[model samples]
Target: MNITFLDSSTLHHKNDLDLSPLKQFGDLTLYETSSIEEIATRIADAEIVITNKAVLNKELIEGAKNLKLILSAATGVNQIDLEAAKAHDITVCNVAGYSTPSVAQHAFTFLLNFATSIPKLDSEKQQWPQSPIFTRLDYPAFDLQGKTLGIIGLGAIGKEVAKIAQAFGMNVQALNSSASSAPSGEIPRVNLEALLKTSDVISLHCPLTEETKHLINRESLSMMKSTAFLINTGRGPLINEPDLAEALDKGIIAGAGLDVLSVEPPAEDNPLIHSQHPNLFITPHTAWATIEARHRLLDGLVENIKNYLAGCPSNQVV
Candidate 1:
């Protein structure tokens, strides 16, 4: 079998994450990046195609005559045309739970920055050292010990984050999207409105769908406490960028710490990208880019390939 990874650099960089595990497979062709115009030709001879972030549209899916299995290097399959793949009998698998620890850790990495105001304090290097006062209390820092953490999504990542929040002596509650599947005893499930109204911190771990897009807009922002903070490490479109920017500027909420934006490599005019608000902090969408997480993703990818070859498909989305 000829397996092609359209974007290989994302999975393995240098010797950090090796591709030797995949050598057991017949043959592999790797491309660091592929343009929209180059996808069809590059995947033309591939029996199995693997990609991260590259769009596998219906036309490209149809154009690949030998393509049998399509593996998404990430959990989300938004880039692939699932309907078209189903029409052509192509098996699609995505690795999930690979980023649970990474994402959970990153959520706090952002939250802690906000709670401690580390960046703000660190930026005042000269002022802090030259000050007459031994202790620099110029900027305020909050504690996470007794705060309420409301998680919007209750999947693997959200659940992991809840555990960490509990360890910090914080109260963890989740928005109950499923009444029948509410978490037992530990994390109380609340309604969306209630979660928005009462929580000290709100984190989004939900998928971006038509209903969830712009979920944290003006109305929802108004519902949160003025001192509350927002964290998004999930899909970008889950929050309204412009509204979030305005909210930060107007002090609607204390701050926002995001690992995603409404757009990737956001346009220069993107409100969030240009905000530069004292409280808003953003990381370049790397909540799941940890080396250990990448290894797990590769392991799942290999398992999917091996299972498919054995006439048993694993992690099938379609």
Candidate 2:
């Protein structure tokens, strides 16, 4: 019953995780590296592999003869090869809903920054001493009240965001992934095109999938209001970065605030890095890494490992 955590550094560096429960089940080994090449060696003799960013493909999975469980610390399992794990009889589980609050809060933070032009105002205030007093009055901010908030993928996190938006007097609407299971109640579900055309502030909260990848592109950007702002806290590939940069340059929309990008630690050549607009806000993908959320994720991962050893695994993906 060997349990090895590859890339434990992601969780270890944040909070003090109680590994007492995990230790009770089996021998535990923790590693810091997330590289595929590194993980292949570290997980060689382990029965259960706990990972946050390490990629477990067929090549790596086949090498781990004793591996029986794959416990992903986070919700997204895109880094793991699910089909291969299923074929190998490896139980794959992921922690979900743990980051709902953290991610939802981050989405609103971006929305507020765009709605109020907080960054531009903050920058201007720093230079106020050199400017005329009249310049201060030029940058008026808008209120969130009466604005239409369009949400894409009204899942738990999106619903939470809608509830908060309602508190600020915002009219909320959503675009559902499937037409039949449309989100009901106060947040009426609308089509993608309609959401883009009518929303004053569009926020993305959907998972990244084949159908959802590049959901926001040049054509969709063109449908948005010139004054509308786009906020994405869901996944990076959900929006096309190049198309978004072009839109920002041409003023296709008012601006954008992205917490996720097509590439993590985006390349220096990325357009968003050098966009010529004061309206764009780019944050390192920290929307789901809040302390509270990380704790929940850790708890879930340990529970999954315990359950797997107990012969009744919870959160099993395969």
Candidate 3:
């Protein structure tokens, strides 16, 4: 079997990952990165194609004459055209639950940074010695205890984040997208309006869909408390960048911490990138790139292919 990895560099950053396990399957061809134009020609004669964040549209999928299986290196499959893969009878599978812990921890990393004002404290450390008191109290900090955390999605990652929030003496709640039945549990589901109005901090973990795209726009931002903070570790399109930038500028909400953007390698003129808000923190979509998480991702990919060869594919998306 011929296996081709279209964008190994996305996962094997700094040559840290070992790709030897993939050798057992067949002749594997690994490309550190593949451009949009290079994908079709590179996978033309391969039986299996693996990609992370590569745009495999209908044209590219149909062009690969020998392609049998498509493996998404990450959990999300938005980059691949599922309708095309299904029409051509190509099997598509993705790795899931591999980055739950890493992403959950990162969400809190942002919340804690905001609550404790860590960056401001570090920047003013030089002035600490001049104070005659035991310690300088120049920056205002808030305790996470007693604060309410509203989560948009209650999947594995959201559940983990809820556990951490409870450990900090904070109340946790999730948005009830489907109101068919009233939820009754530790993390009770509430309507979006209620969540936005009551939560002191909001973290988004839901997948992006037609209904969820730009879910947090001007109207939603206006509903939030003036002192509330926002955190996003899921898909970026969930929030409207222009609206968010304007919100921060006008103090519509307290601040925002984002790990993902509407577009990766965002344009230089992106509103969020140029926002003058001091409370905004943006990480380069690295919440899921921890060393341990990457290893688990790689292991999951290998297991997916192995199962496919055994005639029982795991995590099949199409």
Predicted structure 2: lDDT: 0.86
The residue pairs in collision within model 2 are: none
Cα lDDT tens digits for candidate 3, 7-116: 99999877898988998999999998899989989999999999998889999999998888999999989889999999999999999999999999999999999999
Per-candidate count of clashing residue pairs (backbone under 3 Å): 0, 0, 0
Candidate 3: give the clashing pairs: none
Root mean square deviation (Cα) for candidate 3: 1.4
Model 1 over residues 14-37: C-alpha lDDT tens digits? 768888787788788888889999
* Global Cα RMSD, each model: 1.7, 2.3, 1.4
Span of 10 residues, lowest total lDDT, candidate 1: 177-186
Q: Candidates 2 and 3: which is better by lDDT?
A: 3
CA lDDT, every model vs. true structure: 0.90, 0.86, 0.93
User: What ranges in model 3 sit over 4 Å off?
Assistant: 178-184
**Using TM-score as the measure, what is the rank order of every candidate, best first?**
3, 1, 2
The prediction achieving the highest lDDT against the true structure is 3
TM-score of each: 0.96, 0.93, 0.96
